[model samples]
Target: MNTPHTAAPVARLAAATAAIAHQKRWFARMREEVAAGAPLALVNADAPQEILRAMGIPYVVNQWWASVVSAKRMGPAALDSVAARGYPDDSLQYDAIGLGSMDLPAADVPWGGLPRPDFVIAECGADATRKVFDLWAEHPGTEFFPFERSSATTAPDNWWEIVPREWERAYAEDRLDLMTSENWQLVDFLTERTGRSFDIDRLAEVMALVNEQAEWNRRTRDLLAATRPTPVSVNDSIPAVMIPQWHRGSVWGRDAARALFQEVEQAVRDSRAVCPGERVRLMWIGRGLWFDLGLYQRFQEKYGAVFVWSMYLAIAADGYARYGDDPMRALAARFTGFTDQLYTPPLSSQWYVKEARSHGVDAVVHLVADDVPGSAFTTEALEIAGIPVLEINADNADSRGGAAAALEAAIGDFLERRVLG
Candidate 1:
């Protein structure tokens, strides 16, 4: 008989486990609220959710929920639901999974599934994202709100340094103005629909909380970057940083970030190592493989190769944190071209190279999702920096194509031939 693998106690962090438990409880409460006729908002990952947070509206992030669906092994069935509605099942699986899950039977839904949201909000980015959220509006009692997606007219290499205090220079003024106006519009729309009052002072407080949260993440990221024989796994750090990220404007979110920083600090102080044999430190540059998190750990035992960096934790450290006297504009500055930092050329390519060097990574595995832009530039820049690159073309959410085996094989080959050699 074969035995299933279980993580050793030290390999898992209590902070990651607690975050998961808290999210489940939070979701259960959200479901109950919706059942009692409270309104719910479904916002995209790139949309400004702090507005919803400050207004006291209950909300769920579409991408976060999609991650949950994918992690539960329900991605194929959810995609089937989308196809049943005559939508393109193969496109934007990360954003579309939430819409598809709404059609699934209750028994099949993950985490008892998402409650039917009264409002769907997203930035009108890409050709398909608007269409996906539009489809969401077609359901009864659901309305869609969109913010204009603006392109980055200027690229700044040192965004992480300037964004916290001097955001106007990091992003164009016109882009910030438009998003700030739309944020007010969203506030009005929510107020009219839900009869909740908006307070600018309250928003300022929320923004401060979010910035504090980002600072803690920065500390954790810096600690991990400077540590050798990496202290924590990317798997643990992802949830530890990202679960609280979905609740960014709250006290709990700020504290969660602090807890993660403290936990990693303690681990470092104790000299805990994910791979004590630690020959290679690798970077994962894409959406997490939600269905196969174990992929992060697979090479550790055989090759002493550990995935020490992922964009989830790294972006949380460097991408968030906007400070300004005007709360609404600061919020706008935070989201306008936010995706550009990770997906636009020059900016995306530059940041990835910076992160690679800072983390001291020997190699990178860039999971190339079809929906993400400027991927080629990102891969090329890392190569120019003298980092060995392994490109895997795969959907981070869907597992339907039997691609996992091929992906694993490709990575193994890359490790043996390029990285290990």
Candidate 2:
């Protein structure tokens, strides 16, 4: 928690970061809803949130809950729960962390404990996500639903351009068709169980709101990319952009996006510098540094370095937009290969290189998760594009006991010997 320089707390943070507390209250309300006999879902990050949103079912994202567990430093105890259940604690730490915590005592659980899920939905990714959710479904009242995650067949050089309008060309037709059909099955399954009919009109409305939120995020990202000395920190941007993202396809999420855009624009107008001594503009790749977010600002005084970018905000701008008459088809197009664009071969490489250039990042710090594919290609692409990369191999959530100290030392070494020197 030690920072080199304690800059004056900026007003930008106050306006942009309502999601921190809002999410807690949101989770608590969801628990209440589930306890009162309402059907609740536990879904993967890539699972279709819009479907649940439109159905009026309360749900909690598995990864969001994993983050809460990791942030509270209860990751070890949670993993112990996994180990007690005869599962290997090391494998799929990010996806399984929440499952392990599910059996913990209420006093030990994060966010007042996650209510048991009625529906557990996830895509088959990394050879582990579906299995993790399958285990969750083994609980008495939960039902498991899974879809396939296809590899990237098309590598559009700049995904931000075509994905919004021409996504059919950006991704293969088979992928979208398969996902759309699966969504139909999912809709049928939910209808048979919950007795609530799926409404296409409502889904279309959700898609529209999601697009609006993405547009505002696009504005905020572009503003950050164009600004000198960096108007806002990635630490701040992560919550501002991602909290709304987790609750996407709602009026509140879209409004949050607009609020974030306006807040960043005002910071630019005021010529705010997160680190006034800013010299190195850094780009953080992979999942968030949830263990120690203050790590983003650690080298500010000594190295004049500031982390200006993280995928949480940038992907929001370019990743979530789809426009079409059929809401199911559109939603399928939105998530069919969403993770592929960031973690697959040519698509992942091309997009990261594009982002590094657009952000004018002086250096890159790539956190390579054990279960995620394609970190080597991403690093190679950035280096080939002439941007220096420091690969930190660790789980952003589990921390592996000493991962925080290791990351801190490695980044300091990277900045001194490679970047600043």
Candidate 3:
């Protein structure tokens, strides 16, 4: 299930963490600039910053939308959103409730209650997310769709290696316009009101945060992998990773990782956990549980196995950033282009193996998707490392099928064979 819990030597992740806390007032102040009467717009699940730029509207990002879908808060409401919003019951995502909340309308939900946005911008980036807005207009609310076809899988260049230029042309030309024209227009529209000053210091701060957060994530993942509880539950990590998408570029992400790192340290020092004493370590690859965190805990409880690592937040911290004289362009390079977090090659998973070895994990849960290629190759690599992997066919969010049950049984059997056989 896991190793004996041990204390980790943690380094100061980044000075930006302190800066973010100090500057939190700015984020709050930005929110205050809006008072419902202002020129604002809203989008269900779609990023308001992007669409607001497209429409020339000033609006706040959906703070509440991001929070509710976080690991700790997602529950039955997550399921309701999935089924009602027309998400593939088999797909994993967070936009259903985020976008579904949009259909509720500003007048109905109210700003005081849930930040009533002025308008909605929808994007069809993921097939599941695409349908989120289709239901929004039916609510009699005003909304706009994104240049989706071109942008959905275009961020990372690795996607082209899998799908090729023809598919990109078909998708981008037919449904979305990801050409520089749209991006230039989008930038021109927002650069004025958003008041995006090119702050080199800020770029440096974000870069430090990215590096620190990456180290912290690797450390804590190792801590979790090495230690376990009497009963391992996926819920152990739900709160730390799930809720903080807004904080991705900020220090909050590192703080969360640091706190978890300390938490597991305490657990190990006290010998207060059960999973840590066990011999099974699990690595979750791909998108995490956005809707139902309970599933994570359920598996943990059953197997004494703890999921110490995942790629979403892990890859973000690892892939994003660079220390440079010109940080704005570097920051742009990190995000505007794409790195394959999902699936194009085994190199990403090679990093995972190195991390797994550092963390001393026992196995992996490979959630395969058509969008990602060469996944099986990575799965084989993890296995060859002597960490038996369970290949699962299910979306990260949706868990309605027997696939999960079978996967669980397979995991149980795998562990049983390891521990008792």
Q: Please report the TM-score between candidate 1 and the true structure.
A: 0.97
- A best-first ranking of the candidates according to their lDDT comes to 1, 2, 3
Error of 1 at 377 (Å): 0.7
Per-residue lDDT tens digits for candidate 3, residues 118-147, read 345543455645555554445553444353
Candidate 1 vs candidate 2, TM-score winner: 1
TM-score of candidate 3 on Cα atoms, chains taken together:
0.62
Better model by TM-score: candidate 1 vs candidate 3: 1
Error of 3 at 148 (Å): 8.6
* Superposed model 1: Cα runs more than 4 Å off: 1-9
Q: Write the per-residue lDDT of candidate 1 for residues 333-387, one digit (tens) a residue.
A: 9999789999998988988999999989999999998888899999999999999
Worst 10 residues of 2 by lDDT: 1-10
Q: Tell me, what's the RMSD of every candidate?
A: 3.9, 3.0, 8.0
Worst 10 residues of 1 by lDDT: 1-10
Q: Rank the candidates by TM-score, best first.
A: 1, 2, 3
The alpha-carbon lDDT assigned to residue 215 of candidate 3 equals 65
Error of 1 at 309 (Å): 0.5
Q: How well is each residue in 236-353 modelled by candidate 2, as lDDT tens digits? A: 8888888899899999999999998888777666666788667899999989877788788898888989898999888899899999888899899999978988888788788889
Candidate 2, TM-score vs. the true structure? 0.96
